[model samples]
Target: MSHLFWLDLQNLKRIQHLFPKPRGVARSDDRKVLSGISHVIRNGLRWRDAPAEYGPHKTLYNRFVRWSRLGVFARIFRELAQPGPDGKTIMIDSTHLKAHRTAASLSKGGLKPRAIGRTKGGLNSKLNTVCDGRGRPLTFFLSAGQMSDAKGALALLGSLPPAKILLGDKGYDADWFREALAERGIAACIPAHRGRRDPASHDPCMYRKRHRVENLFARLKDWRRIATRYDRCGELFLSAICIAATVIFWL
Candidate 1:
């Protein structure tokens, strides 16, 4: 078994504040529960494979599912991901995660589709991410892998903090998007798509910074669970991403 990464005392205390104390004897075992959650995300272990030191695998899985629904992980990510001073420049990009065969076995009406779709890479989901200049993930939106980057870019607009410049690839070089950024006093450093006959001019110097978002995606996929989709439900999958992102932010 791969060595699982456990939350340190400082991070555990940070997360413990987000989870309240239970009123009755059904109280949570904080360390064990956190360890179980960390093991799953860090090692990509199936729920049943979780070590007994953490707790009953089923109980841990149930808690994770419940908390995902409550958006606890999302809140924790937001709290810890405070934008740095260098956040004046933000980079946006998208990457795909191949969906495991088991993730496609979702029963009907249980939840909406989990953003998986057929693409050149096979069945995969796309994660559109925004990262700070230092390559720290700020926010991300999920969509089917086949979805257009322009559509994914729409989700990046509202989630980002005020920045002086936004760096992106050719996919984000639409006229309307550039105009929107210009109106907001944010420079668009995206390169034009090849198909455009009259490509708009952009600063070649700043466009080089687009690599940071790509670096963020590479770092995020270091977690095996994030590199391959395992959670059948979209919210649970997103919670997994948020948890991974939170750890990266802390580091």
Candidate 2:
């Protein structure tokens, strides 16, 4: 395994227990299988291109697909991503990833909307995330690139730990959303949209910290696979995102 995976032996031990024991011949070389997963996400390499050190590329690819379907990576992310110190405030934001054409073509029986959208950037996907006060990711949601930032807002909010204040840009300033936050006893610190009939009030000082979520996105994109979409299946791509978050952010 390369030095890329920061999770040490102890952390690895903690992570290993999350999955039920793998059955069959594929169960061997679990460590290298995981290492190969990390490698592919870090380098954004195709399964066939994974280095020999990680193990056979076919095994790695099959393992990744199996894990994706089983939500193993997502479980790892949830278990490891500890809540940030300032739990009272949650920052929400979204970023777009340019999807390669390889990710656009689907088999005849494939699913629709795969979270890819046509945009000024061509084919793209939206990655919406919620971060804690210190910019640690709490939850993530993916939608088509052209989807409004607020499209996935409720889903992201639902996954977050209870927080007192929700910070966001003008895009999240909808009346319904504010009301939704209020119902949970959370203060909406989102800036009012320019076209609002009556502008809502928010603390400007607190809003400045919205940059923390932006910074989180910047760090996530540092993973080449995340910077550019490659997987045709949305679930697989999301699994990749979870792997990156667990290894790079949570670790």
Writing each residue's lDDT as its tens digit, candidate 2 over 115-187 gives: 8898898989999988889898978899989999777897676776788999999888888888988989999
Weakest 10 consecutive residues of candidate 1 by summed lDDT: 104-113
Candidate 2: stretches off by over 4 Å = 1-7, 107-113
Model 1, which residues run further than 4 Å from truth?
107-111
TM-score versus the correct structure, for each prediction: 0.93, 0.93
- Residue 22 error, candidate 1, Å: 1.8
Best by lDDT: 2
Query: Would you list the clashing residue pairs of candidate 2?
Result: none
Q: Report each candidate's C-alpha RMSD, comma-separated, in the order given.
A: 1.9, 1.9
